[model samples]
Target: MVFKRLRQALGVGGPSVETVLANPECRPGDHLEGHVQMVGGDHPVELTSVALGLVTRVAVESGDSAYGTMQEFGRRQVTDAFRLDPGQRYDVPFRFEVPWETPLTDLFGQRLSGMTVELRTELEVTRAVDQGDLAPVAVHPLPVQERLLEALLRLGFRLAGADVERGHLYGVHQTLPFYQEIEFFPASRYAGTINQLAVIFMTDPQQTRVLLELDKRTPGRFTGGDGFGRFTVDHATATHTDWPAQLDTWLRHQAG
Candidate 1:
């Protein structure tokens, strides 16, 4: 029975955790709910605080290669000092708002593969020492976002990848340290007109802010004054309208 006892002891001794958000996805000024579960180990321990972080992965350029780093963009303290006895268990819950300028993870109906936004939990057992993470919360895309992405695929643009990058445009109010970029490759018809398009959505409760940046392989003689278009669409229209035609119309104006 020694081997069986050891195996069972090692397997079930660690902490068990769970995280949830009443509304997993939110507009600006909206709140996210979180729940965490912790179970005592073989011995008793003093607890400090339970912390939650809103994190995203970012790719940074370093020399000839690129590397990904986890950025903890937002953090919250959910529970204060406590103590746990051997074989005891507990749960802590919280509610917090997503930042107003949170980037769009999806535009229409597709998943942004390279994009990962996680609500992570950290157990602070002491003044400065804390366990890295217990669980991750997923934030899904909004309805208006789904509609817009559906429009893109219909327009023949293929999803390249998406990421959150650090920086701000010349004229925009940015609250978070980074912004999300959902990128696309031009389909055949627009391949000759444009190389790639990067779309960004800055959202709040009332509107969906859209930023489109195009990298064009200019033809020999056609002169286009600018290569990018930035605009905003209200939430009502984004959900009620057909975006493929609207997007095509926007692209036509860009070509002219």
Candidate 2:
């Protein structure tokens, strides 16, 4: 009897969980609607709580070596204190608001090489917690963001890769702990002058602040330094501005 009790306490008879998102594709500042379907195990179990979180892999730097780590950026509790009878089934629906600063995982219908976002459901049994597999989610760019990306493409910058860095920018009002850097390789015209460019967008409902970092190429062994430029515009203004021209001016100023 004692052994059986111990086994149950250790989650041998815990419940199983499967989460389904109504739609896997979303944009930043949007809401994700989903349902958590659960089935009781062989025996009745007491559940402490049920919750969901948004998780992704981020690049972390330590002691001159950099490694990637899985991090949870957002979480929401779905339920608390539930009793599951043997073989019983229950469904819990949830509407989670995606943060305004959520990173983009897809562009032009293609997934970024190293970028991913997933929805994870966690079922808390007496003393054990079971986490479900990552439900893949594709986060697309906002309207303003799309315009900027299109402009860059028109200027001959190709998408290289993107990653989230595990720290705050030097002078940015970032609500989240990390920021996404969308990288691009310079066009043929500027290949000799610039190695690459990384862009970061800091946004709110009112406006977006665009940060540009240009990595210059050098002839000598010593690497060239990064040049920075910042600009702010409202959503309406973003659509009308001549981004390619403005970007060209910025690059010229940075290179000189």
Q: How accurate is candidate 2 locally (lDDT)?
A: 0.82
Give per-residue CA lDDT, model 2, range 1-256, as digits (tens). Answer: 0000011222566666667778888888898897887777888888888888899888999998999998887798999888988889888989988888888999987888789898877777666776656787889998888888888999999999999989888877888888899999998878888899999988888788889888888533224567878888798777788888988887777765
Would you give me the overall lDDT of model 1? 0.67
Count of backbone collisions within predicted model 1 = 4
lDDT of 1 by residue, 1-256 (tens): 0000011121345444445545555544556765565667777667777777778787776779887888886678888898777768687767776776654554344446777666666766655454444243345556666677668888998989888876666687666767888888987777777788888777777776778877777742234533677777787777667789989888766754
Per-prediction TM-score: 0.78, 0.91
Cα shift from native, residue 127, model 1 (Å): 4.1
Query: What's the count of clashing pairs in each model shown?
Result: 4, 0
For each candidate, what is the lDDT?
A: 0.67, 0.82
Lowest-lDDT window of 10 residues in candidate 1?
Answer: 1-10
User: What are the RMSDs of all candidates, in order?
Assistant: 5.9, 6.2
Displacement of the residue 70 alpha carbon in candidate 1, Å: 0.4
lDDT at 162, model 2? 95
